[model samples]
Structures are given as structure tokens and as C-alpha cells.
Target chain A: MTQQDRAHATREAILHAAAQEFDRLGYERTSLTAVLARAGLTKGAFYFHFPSKEAVADALVERQTELWAQVRESWRLRGVDPLSALHGMFAESADRMAADVVLRAGVRLNADREVGYPGVPSTHLMWEKLVATYVIEAAERGDLRPGVDPEAVARTLCSAALGSRLISSATTECADFPSRIREVLGHVLPCITAPAWELSGSQSASEPA
Target chain B: MTQQDRAHATREAILHAAAQEFDRLGYERTSLTAVLARAGLTKGAFYFHFPSKEAVADALVERQTELWAQVRESWRLRGVDPLSALHGMFAESADRMAADVVLRAGVRLNADREVGYPGVPSTHLMWEKLVATYVIEAAERGDLRPGVDPEAVARTLCSAALGSRLISSATTECADFPSRIREVLGHVLPCITAPAWELSGSQSASEPA
Candidate 1:
């Protein structure tokens, strides 16, 4: 392998090691020495790549945010109908909660403000904005209920989606969690559906569409 | 005064110290030494009151749960109708969230499981039972829709309530959070209203008594 490839591999190794140790022991208790130990590298090597513990945390946050955005964009590019797209998004999210350690740590950081990680709050805001944009697009296309403010509905939906993430993260034995989230999304979607009943012929359905 | 009073004072001091430290640095990072220092006691005195960090967290959880139960029972006893009682409950919870640090920490724990305390799974289950009890009572009184399953509806409501809690926790400037919570609850209450929306009379009345 080239020198560049080896350097990239070392960087990825440090990130992976940091995420696992931070998740296992948390941010403050996790020392630079432990991270170097876990990565099988010296402190000098660690300092060569990252400046501080906070920088490592910031990098992880950025990676997780990119991961979420990529997931959303990939779904959007497929042009799935809005509601199904939402379900797919949350289902994929819960699936991550069930599997990814770095993502889980990122979620835990989202929950506690004391553990400051860069881009965490912005990640949340960005997720909400994405949900709102799609819902508004669906509403414009006559796929959503009539007379509903897509932004408000999007906020509620985003809230529910985030809450689902929290629930999935809180348990280890939540084996049926992804299905439960999909089911709950099914129940909540109707509330935001236009016409409120008939899902199309109810009161709001009369709006020009 | 009495020996009981001295013991109680010491216990209260420890809890207060622990709560502050926990809130300041979270459950994992807050050291027992800091808690003892904050409480103006030695490690022996701290251990006399609580055995471990986990024990302190458990005590806080127990206390919060008992307080919320009383909060719910008080709402029922005040003769508020089921719907208004439900609204009032959410509003009251928002008020509590605004006022208390410990309760805020508990809400954070409930939302992001990997942070704050590790007992978030049990906390989520406790909330499920809490909401389930109210939904069932409301159903029996002809307050909920006929087709709704209390358990399922309870889970859904808990999800939304937690969703609202999440928004509230994440934002410091949303002054109308309580009203927004009520609005979401208002929309959801109809979907689960008793006798489940008859075709003719659904438009005129605000959810039946």
C-alpha cells in the first residue's frame, strides 16, 4: 500500500477506536492514552492526526451527520411516496440504533447537553428541515391532507421520529422495535393526511389540488 | 430535633448535591468525591446515605416516578373531565419541566437513553404503564373512541408526549411549547376518542364527556 493509504487507514483506526471507547466509557473518563492504547498507536501518532479529544468528538459527529444526510438523500432520490419514505427513514434509523455503536453514541450525545459534541444540535435541525421539505412537497402534490401546515406537521413528525430513535436506543432487547416504529408511523400519518377521513374526501379535501 | 430528622436532613443533602452534580456533568462523569464535596461530607457520610452511583440514580428515578403519579392523581381528583384532565396533565408536565432540574434530567434520560443515567429503559416502561393507565380509564368512561385499543393508544400517546418532551428539551426559546403540546394532543385525542367518531355528530361537539 502507498503511504497515503496507510495514513488514511490509521486515521480511520483512531476514529473507530475513539468512538468505541467513548461510547463504552463516555467522553470525560475516556483519556487520550486509552484511545492510543486501543488504536495500538503512540500518543505522538495520535497528536499527529487530531489535536484534542473534542476534535475527535467533532469528527465523529460530522461523520454521523453525513451518514444520516446520505441516507435521507438516497431515499429522496428514489422518489418514494412521502409517507412510505418517512417510514423507511425511521425504520432505517431504528435499525441503526439496533446495530451501530458510533451512531448510538451520537444519539446519546443528542440526549445530554452536558456532553457537548459539535454539530449535534445542527444535525437535529437539519433532520427536521429535511422532513419538513418532503412533507411540503407531498402536500403540494396532493399526497398530504388538505389545509394542514406542512411545516407544523413536519415538526410533529420529526418529533415522533426522534422520539422513536430514543426509544430504540434505550433498550437492548427491543427486538420488535423497528416494526413497532413503523406501526406507530402508520397511526400518526393519518392525522396529517388531508381530509382527515376518507383520507381524501373529508372536509379539507375540497381544497384545490 | 429527632434522630430521624438528622438522618433525613443528611439524606436530602446528599440527594441535592448529587442532583446538582449529575445535572452539571451527567451520571457517568460526576464522581462520588465531587458529590461528597458538594454535600460538604466525607466519603463515609456519602456512603451512609447511598451505596453507589447507580443507587443514587435509582433513588432519583423512584422519587420522580412517585411525584408524577401524585401529579396525575391530583388532576383526576380535581374533577377535570377526561379530555381537559389530559390537557392539563401535559401542561402541568411542561410547567414542571420548566421549573425543575431533576425532572429535566429525567426527561433527558427518557429521550436519549445513552446519556444521563443508564436506567432509561425502565423509565420508558414506567411511562408506558403510566400513560396506559390513563388511556384505559378514559376509555372506560366513554371518553376514548370505540375501536381504539387502550394499550396501543397508550403507547402512541406516550410516544407523542415524549416527542413533545424532546422538542421542549432541545429548545430554550420556544415559549409556546406548552400550547404546541396541547395542540398535538388535541389532534391525537380525536383519533382515539370514544365510540370512535360517529359520522353525523362528529362536527359539532368538542370531544364528549
Candidate 2:
């Protein structure tokens, strides 16, 4: 293998190990030594890849943001309108959150302001802004009810989504995350759907599209 | 003063001081020494009032539970219907959360499961159950939209409320918590309120009744 290829592999190993530790112990409690031990790498090799644990956490948050962006683009590329894209985007998100260690670690780290990791922007804010853009687009397409403010609808949706994750995680080890989010959409979507769109709707947004 | 009164005052002082420390430092980072210092009490006095920090957290959670019960009873005594009682209960809750340090500390501690304070039940579950009961009552009174599940609306509302608090605190020091929750109710309430009640509704549930 090329030297560059080996370096990339080493870096990926360190990141994966660190994410596991963070996912298990949370940001403040996770230690650098434990990460190095998990990665089976020397201290020097670990330092060569990243400056500090906080930097590793920041990278994880960035990667999670990228995951959301990818989901958003994939749905948009399918030629679905903004309202329909939301169902696709969040379904992809719930699937990733349930299985990806990095995504879980990043979410847990970002939620913890106590860790003082200000190197990266708030992922929740980014997620909310993305949802807001969709809401605005849906409004322009006359999918939203008249007199509904796009920003308000977006904020409410984002809040409810996060709340669902918290409640589901607490109650059922997050086994019901998808259904919880679906229920949120089911109740809120009916209130916001335009009269024309409501009449045209064949199924609820919470259901498979 | 009687010995009983003096002992009660001492316990209250210790609890108040511990809450401030938890609010500032969170569950994992807060040290018992700091709480003692903040309360300006000797080690003997601290031990006399509480056995450990975990016990203190348990007490705080119990106290927060009591606060919710107070709000629920106040609304029930007013003879308001189930749907209307929710508005009053949540408004009072928001006011208490905004002004009470103990309530803030309790919420923070309860959210952190890492502390292992299983001595008390999950407060979120209790709150959700209370909401579910109200929703069921509303359904029985023909206040809810037909075919809507009372438990589902209750779950969504509770989740949205927590999400609003998380977002508001992260962005605006929680100054807009009331309005954020109001927006959630505004969007979701219309969907759940029966069409018959919809016509009778003069003002939005998001607004003061």
C-alpha cells in the first residue's frame, strides 16, 4: 500500500475508536488513553492524526452534518417537491441514527455544551435551518395552509423531532424512534397542509411514500 | 424557634445550595465540596441533611414532580375541561421553570441518566402519563378530532415541549421558551381539536385563554 493510503487508514481507525468511546462514556468522561487503546495505536500515531480529543469530537459533528446533507441532496435529486422530500430525508436520518456509532456520538457530544467544544457549529441549528428551507420551499409551492408562517412551522417540526428522539431513547432504548417521528409528522402535517394539497393527499406523510 | 423548624430550615438551605451547583456544573462535573462551600455549611451539617449528591438529585427530582402535581391540581380545581386545563398547566409550568433554580436543576439532573439515580421514577414518563390522561378525558368529552389517538397527541405535545426548551436554551438563554412551546401547540392543536370545537374556538390555544 502507498504511504498515504496507510496514513488514511490510521486516521480512520483512530476516529472510529474515539467515536465508540464517546458514544459509550459521553464527551466529558471519555479519555484519550482509552481511545488510543481501543484503536491499538501508539500515542505518537494517534497524535499524528488528531491534535486532541475535542478535535476528534468536532470532526464527528462535521461528519454527522455531512450525513444530513447527503440525505437532503439524495431526496432533492429524486425530483420530489420540498414537502415530499422531508419524509424521505427524516426516514434516512432515523435509519442512520439507529445504526451509526459516529452519528450517535456526534449527537451526544453536540448536545453536551458542558464539554466546551465550540470548534464546530451547533448541529441542531444546522438541522433546523435545513428543515426551515424545506418549509419555505413547500410554502412557495402552495403546499402549506394559507396564513401559516414557514419559519414557525419549521421550528415546530424540528423541536418535535428532537423531542421524539429523547423520549424514545429514554423509554425504549430508541427502538421506536422512527414511529415517534412519524407520529409527530402525522399530527402536525394535517394542520399545515393546504386545503388543495389536503384534498390531493392520498396518504399521510408519516406513512411510507 | 423550635428544633423541628430549625432542622427544616437547614435542609432547605442545603438543597438550595446543591441545586445552584448542579445548575452551574451539571451532574458529572459538580463536586460535593463546591455545594458545601456554596451553602457555607460544615461537613457535619452537610452529611446531616443529605447522604450524597445522588440522593440530593433524587430529592430534586421528587420536588420537581411535586411542582407538576401542584399545577395539575390548580387547573383541575378551576373546573375547566381537560383540553383547556392543559393550557393552564403548561403556562404555570413554564413560569415556574423560568423562575425556579430548583426546577431547572431537577430537569438537568433527570435528563442525565449517567448518574444512576433510579431511586426516583422517570419524571418525563410521569409528565407524559399526566398529559395522556388529559387527552383521554378530552376524547371522551368530544373535544378531540375523530379517529385521533389520545395517547399519541399527548406524547407528541410532551416531546415538543422538551425540544422547545432545548432549542430556546441553546440559542436565547431560554428567554423564548414560552413562545416556542406556544408555537408547538399552535401548529399541533388545530390538528387535534375536533372540527365542532374548531368553530367554537375564538382564540388560538397558543394564546392566553
Candidate 3:
């Protein structure tokens, strides 16, 4: 590998190891030594990519945010309706949360306050904004019921989504996270959707992206 | 104070201090020494009431459960309808979360998995059952729309409530918790409740109980 490519590979490896540790041990208990051990990298290489454990965590949060943005952009490019796109986005994210250790760790780190991570609140606000933007589009496209406030609906759904994930993590290790989110959307969509518009299928979002 | 009354007060004091410390510092970081210092009791008095930090957390969880039960009973006694009673119960709990440090600490401790608290899962299950019971009663009384699954609806609402509280705690230290939960119910109730039974007022639940 070229020097640049090798450096890139090492950085990705460190991130992967950090995410796994955070997901498994949580942010407070996870140590740089443990992450180094998991990555099988020496201290010199580890410090070359990241300055501290918090820096690794911040990078993970940034990466998670980028992943979410990509999901939204992909759905938009596919000409999916705003409402369906929102559903699909959460479904896709939940899939990642279940299968991808880095994404799962990012989520856990964002939710944990004791870590003193600064990006957690902004991450939540970003999701809220993204959901609200879609809600507005859906409202304009005649997808939402009359008199539904896009911002309020967005906040409610955002809160519900947050709650479902936390509950799943606490109760079941999120084995059924996809279905749990589907259940939340099922209850919520009927209230927000225009009576005339039928949901193509409630299970569509849970399908692998 | 009599010996028994004085002992009871001391135990309560210790739990209160522990809750505050847990709420402020989270479960992993909160030290027993901090709790004792905050309670103004010596190590001897603290040990007299509790064996260890884990024991204090367990007692807090138990106390939180009792507080929830008390809210439900108070609403039931007042002849509130099941749907309204559920709203009132959550509202009252949120109020306590904002004003009562012990309850807030209990909630944070329960949510923190790194603490390795055993009662956490049971606490969530207990809430699910309580919500389901009320949802079943509401359905039986024709308050909820037909074909609503009590268990499913209960789970959804329970998850939503959990999410709202967590969000509020994280963002605003729960200053807006009452309104945040009210918003959750406002969106959810329309889906679950029969159209005939209007919520007396969305903000009514926020009123002092």
C-alpha cells in the first residue's frame, strides 16, 4: 500500500476498535489501552490518528451524522416521497445500529451524558430538523393530515424514535430494534398521514436498504 | 423524634442524598462519600441504613417505583378516566422529575446501564404493565378506538414517555419536561383515543397535581 493509503487504513482500524469498545463497555469505562489492544496497534500509531479517546468519540459522532445525511440524500435522489423517505431513513439507520459496531457505539456515546460529549445535543437537534424538513415537504405534498404542525410532528416523532431505541437497548439489547421502530411508525403514521393516502406497506422501511 | 421515626428520617435522608449525587454525577461517577456528605450523615449512619452504593441505588429504584404507584393510585382515587389518569400520572412524574432531586436521580440511575443495576429492566417492565393496564381499561370503557391493541399501544406510549423524559433530562435538565411530555401525548392521544372523548386540555396535565 502507498503511504497515504496505509495511513487511511490505520485510522479506520482505530475508529473501528474505538467504536466497538464504546458500544460494549460504554464511554465512561472504555480506555485508550483497551482500544489499542482491540485494534492491535501500538501507541505511536494510535496517537498518530487520534489525540485522545474523546477525539475518537467525536469522530464517530461526526461519521454517524454523515451516514444519516447520506441516507437522506439517497432517498431524495430516488424520488421517494418525503414521509416514506423519513421512514426509510430511520429503518436504514436502525439496520446499521444493529449490524454496525461503529454506528452503534456512536449512538451509545451520543446518548451518554457522563462522557461530557458536546455533540450529543446537536446530533439530536439535527435529526429533529431533518425530520421536520420532511414533515413540511409531506404536508405540502398533501401527505399529512390537515392542521398537523410539521415542527410538532417532527419533535414528537424524533422523541418517540429516541425513546424506542433507548428502550430497546435497555430491555432487549436491541435485537428487535427494526420492528420496534416499525411499531412506533405504525402508531404515529396513522395520526399524521392524510386519511386518503394509504401507507404502501408498513414493513417496507424495515427491509434492508 | 422517637427512635423509629428518627431512624426512618435518617434512611430517607440518605436515599435523598444518594439520589442527588447520582442525578448530578451519574451512577458510575457518584461516590458513596459524596452522598453521605450531602446527607450530612457520618459513615456510621450511612452504613446503618445501607450496605453499599449498589444498595442505595436499589433502594432508589424501589422508591421510584413506589412514587409511580402513588401517582396512579391518586388518580384512580380521584375518579379520573383511564386515559386521563395515564396522562396525569406521567405529568405528575415529570413534575417530580423537575422538582424532586431524588426522583430525578432514580430515573438517571435506572437509565444508566454502566451501573450494572439489576432492577433497571424490571422497572421498565413494571411501567409497561402499568401503562398496558390503563390502556386495557380505556379500551374496555370505549375510550380508545376499536381494534387498538392494548399491549402494543401501551408499549408505544411507554417508549415515548421514556424517550421524552430522557430528552428533557439531557437537553434542559428537564425544565421543559412538562411541555415536552404534553406534546408527546397530544400527538399520541389522537391516534389512540376515541374522537368523542376530547382531552380536557393538553396543558391540564402540567398543572400542579
Candidate 4:
């Protein structure tokens, strides 16, 4: 590898170790020495890439943002219906949370205010904005019922997702996260979708007024 | 006052002080010495009632359960419709969380699993059970739409409330908790309530399917 490529690999290794340490012990209890040991790198090497623990956390948050943007772009390229695309994106994100320790750690750190990573967008707000964008498009296409406020439905969906994930993480350690997300969408979609466009049998299509 | 009454008062004072301390600094950072100073009690007096910090946290969770029960009973006595009663109870609870230090502290502690209070009922499960009871009654009375599942709706509502509260607490320090709750209920009620029994204009009543 070239000198620059080796530097990039070292930075990625440090981030991977930091994510595992943060996920296992939370931001408050995770130790720099332990992270360095887990990364199999000397303290000098660790500091060569990231100056501090908070800097690592900020980088993780930024990485999550980039990851989500890529997920959205991939879904957009598939050219699916807007609501279906929203559901697919959320389900895909939940699957990633179930499998990716780095994503889960980044989410946890972003939620923790004491971590002091200011200017990092909250996961909830980011999800809300994404959902709202899709809901607005769906509404323009008459997929949502009349008078359904896109912003309100989007906000509720985001909150339900957040709440379900939090409970699942606490109770089952997120082993059931994707199913919980399915349940949340199942409950919420019936309230917002137009009767003719209702997607799942779990929801009864609303009758005409 | 009798000696026993004075002792009870002192115990209450110590708990109140501890809740404030824990809320401000979280479970890991709170100092018992600061709690004693806030409560204006000697360390001997503080230890007389509660053996340790974990004991205080356990007591706080228990207290929150009792408080919620009383709120539910008071709403039941008022003889309102089940869905409206649930909304009232949640709104009242949010108001209390905004104005009451002990209740807010109890909620924060309950969410933090590292506090290690075994067998303590999670605030989410407790709310879900309470919401389910009301939803079941509403369904039996035909207030909910056909095919609506009380348990599922209740779980979603509870989760949404939790997510909204978490977001509110993080962004606005929960100063906007009640309104956020109002938004959650407004979005959720439309999906669950029967068309003929829809509650308010804030929610677009689901058209008959």
C-alpha cells in the first residue's frame, strides 16, 4: 500500500476499535487506553489519527450521516413508490443496526448529550426529515389520505421508531429490532395512507367519509 | 409533630434532594455529599433512611409507579371517555415531568440500565400496560375501529410517547414535553378510533373503510 493508503487503514482501524468500546461500555465509561489496546496500536498511533475521544465520536457521527445518505441514494435508484421506499429504507437501517456495532455505537453516542459532540445531527431529526421528504412526495401522488399532514405523520413515525428501538435495545439488547420496526410501521401506516393505497393486510383500509 | 412524623419528613426530604442531584448529574456523577447538603441533613441522617444510592433509585422508581397509579385513578373517577382519559392522563404526567423534579429524575433513572435496578418495571412497559387497559375498554365499547388491536396500538402509543419525550428532553430539556405528547396522540388516535367516534379536529378522522 502507498503511504497515504496505510494512513487511511490505520484511521479506519482506530475508529472500528472506538466504536466497539463505546458500544460495550458507553461514552462515559469507555477508556482511551482500552481502545488503543483493542485497536492493537500504540498511543502515538491512536493520537496520530484522532486527537481525543470526543473527536472520535464526532467522526463516527459523521460516518453514520454518510452511510445513511448512501442508503437513501441506493433506494432512490431503485425507483420504488415513495412510501415503500421509506419503509425499505427504515427496515434496511434497522437491519444495519442489528448487524453493525459501529452504527449502533454511533447512534448511542449521538443520543448522549454528555458526550459533548455538539453540531452532530440527532438521529431522530435526521430520520424525521428523511421520512417527511418521502411523505410529502407520497401526498402529492395521492397516496396519503386527505388532510394527512406529512410533517405530523413523519414526526410520529420517527418517534415511534426511536421509542421502539430504545425499548428493544434495553429489554432484548436489540435482538428483535427489525420486528419491532415492522410493528411500528404496521401501526402507523393505517393512520396515514389513503384507503386504496394501503400496503399491508395488518392495516384495514379506511372507509370513505 | 410526633417523633415518627418528623422522621418520615426527614426521609422524604432526603429522597427529594437525591432526585434533584441525580437528575442534574446523572446516576454516575451525582455525589452523596451534595445530596446531604441539598437536603440539609447530616450524613448519619441520610444513611439512616437509605442504605445506598441504588436504594434511593429503587425507591424513586417505586414512587413513580405510585404516582402514575394515582393519576389514572383520578382520571377514572372523572368518568371521561377511555381515549380522552388516556390522553388526559398522559398530558398530566408530561406536565408533572416538566414541573416536578422527582418524577423527571425517576424517569431518567429508569431508562438507564447501568443503574442495575433488578426487577424494576420499565417505564415503557408500565405505560403500555396502562394504555392497553384503556384501549381494550374502548374497543369493547366500539370506540375503536373494526380490526384494531388494542395491545398493538397501546404498545405503539407508549413507544411514541417515550421517543418524543426522549427527543424533547434532549433538545428542549423537556420544556415542550406536553405539546410533543399532544402531537403523538393526535397522530395515533386517528388510526385506532372508529370513524363515528373520532375525538377532535386536530386528528383527521379515518374515513369509513
lDDT (Cα atoms) of all candidates against the true structure: 0.64, 0.75, 0.77, 0.77
Off by over 4 Å in 2: A1-14, A32-51, A114-126, A198-209, B1-14, B32-48, B114-123, B198-209
lDDT tens digits, residue span B1-209, model 3: 99999999999999888887787677778898888889999999988988899999988877877887787677878786788878877777887788887888877777665222323545566777879998899899999888878877777787787777766666667777777777777777888788887654233634656
Residue B18 of candidate 1: its Cα lDDT? 79
Weakest lDDT window of 10 consecutive positions for candidate 2 chain B:
B199-208
Please give, for residues A82-131, the per-residue lDDT of candidate 4 as tens digits. 88777777777777887777887787777665311223455667667878
Q: Return the DockQ of model 1.
A: 0.26
For every model in order, what is the number of clashing pairs? Answer: 11, 0, 0, 3
Model 1 has an lDDT value of: 0.64
Looking only at chain A, give the TM-score of model 2 against the true structure. Answer: 0.79
Each prediction's DockQ?
0.26, 0.42, 0.40, 0.36
Give the chain B TM-score for each candidate: 0.67, 0.81, 0.83, 0.80
lDDT of 1 by residue, A1-209 (tens): 99999989999889888877766555666788888898999888888889998888878877777777877786677666776566667777666655666776655544444222322464455566888887777787787766777777666666666555555445443344565565566566766666532321111111111
- Candidate 4: give the clashing pairs: A206-B209, A207-B208, A207-B209
lDDT of 3 by residue, A1-209 (tens): 99999999999999999987787677778999999999999999988989889999999988887887787677778776788878877777777787787887788787664222323555566667878998999999999989888987887788887777766666666656777787777778888899876644233634655
- Minimum summed lDDT over a 10-residue window in model 1 chain A is located at A200-209
> Candidate 2: what lDDT?
0.75
Candidate 4 chain B lDDT trough over 10 residues, lowest sum: B200-209
TM-score of 4: 0.75
- lDDT value, candidate 4, whole model: 0.77
- TM-score pick, better of 1 and 4: 4
